[model samples]
Target: MTTQHLEHPTHTHTHGPDCGHQAVSHGDHVDYAHDGHLHREHSGHWDECESGAHTTHDGHTHVHGSDCGHEAVRHGDHVDYVHDGHRHAEHDGHYDDH
Candidate 1:
């Protein structure tokens, strides 16, 4: 019998205050950004922004004060990633939380 080798799943991520993957960023808002697809729960805005506004993450990652369940889709200036079917939509404003 011949022996075969199996490969392990690789995971390499880079996200932080100064992540280079960021395309458009302002204060705590990001747009047109696309990170690798690794199937993981990303961060998002959970609390109010004092201005009674709810932040959203289009097709990118966003860290929050607490853990948030945000996968992301094509919203606003965010990049489209419907190749595998996640969810997408376009708005007048950005839906990404820096």
Candidate 2:
């Protein structure tokens, strides 16, 4: 079995007075086959922020506050694995051996 790995770095920023402003960060990893079709895995963690605060991740920010009250903000990551046989060959037309 062959293994391929990749890493991605991320950053986050938050602002607020009652919740306290701060920054958050996390990392991600992926595994796949040489043919770009196989199993995959990933994991990461985000810094903790307070309620009524605005948090920004990877350029997207969530403001935690009601019309004019305090609110809570939550975020997370996702992972997807796919196994395709002819998906790439059909797209690139590079399948020499049929």
Candidate 3:
């Protein structure tokens, strides 16, 4: 997986345990959910958490798409389906955490 390389410009608010935004674990880092998107602290700056490892959601038989009964969020290059308490994105014939 690769990072988007897109920095969130003029980001003044620091996200953390008490930042009010929901914290989601992404691979080896923590990303904060804010403004309908995910943000990660990187190199003293903030970037949209858009890329990561292709972790397959085993036993996930439900296909996510239009009218899939889940909230579809427009991500950088693809759509993520909100299920349970996390987001899932389709990649390489499986769903990965977004």
Model 2 global lDDT (CA atoms, 0 to 1): 0.23
TM-score of each: 0.21, 0.18, 0.61
Q: Per model, state how many residue pairs clash.
A: 2, 0, 0
- Model 3 spans with C-alpha error above 4 angstroms: 52-59, 62-86, 90-97
TM-score of 3: 0.61
Whole-model lDDT per candidate:
0.31, 0.23, 0.78
Cα deviation of 91, candidate 1, in Å: 11
Question: Which whole-number lDDT from 0 to 100 does residue 63 have in model 3?
Answer: 90
Give me the candidate number with maximum TM-score: 3
Count backbone clashes in candidate 3.
Answer: 0
- List model 1 lDDT by residue over 12-57, tens digit each: 4443546554333323433324333212212431111111233455
The runs of at least 3 residues in candidate 2 whose Cα sits more than 4 Å from the true structure, single-residue gaps closed, are: 1-3, 11-41, 45-86, 89-93, 96-98
1-98: candidate 3 lDDT, tens digit per residue: 56577799888999999999867766678777777777899999998887545656778888998989987766656777778765788989888865
Poorest lDDT segment (10 consecutive residues) of candidate 1: 44-53
TM-score of 1: 0.21
Q: Residues 25-98, candidate 2, lDDT per residue (tens digit)?
A: 21232222212222223345222211122221222122222342322122222111121221011112222110
The candidate with the higher lDDT, 1 or 2, is 1
User: Judged by lDDT against the true structure, how good is candidate 3?
Assistant: 0.78
| CA displacement after TM-score superposition, residue 61 of candidate 2 (Å) | 46
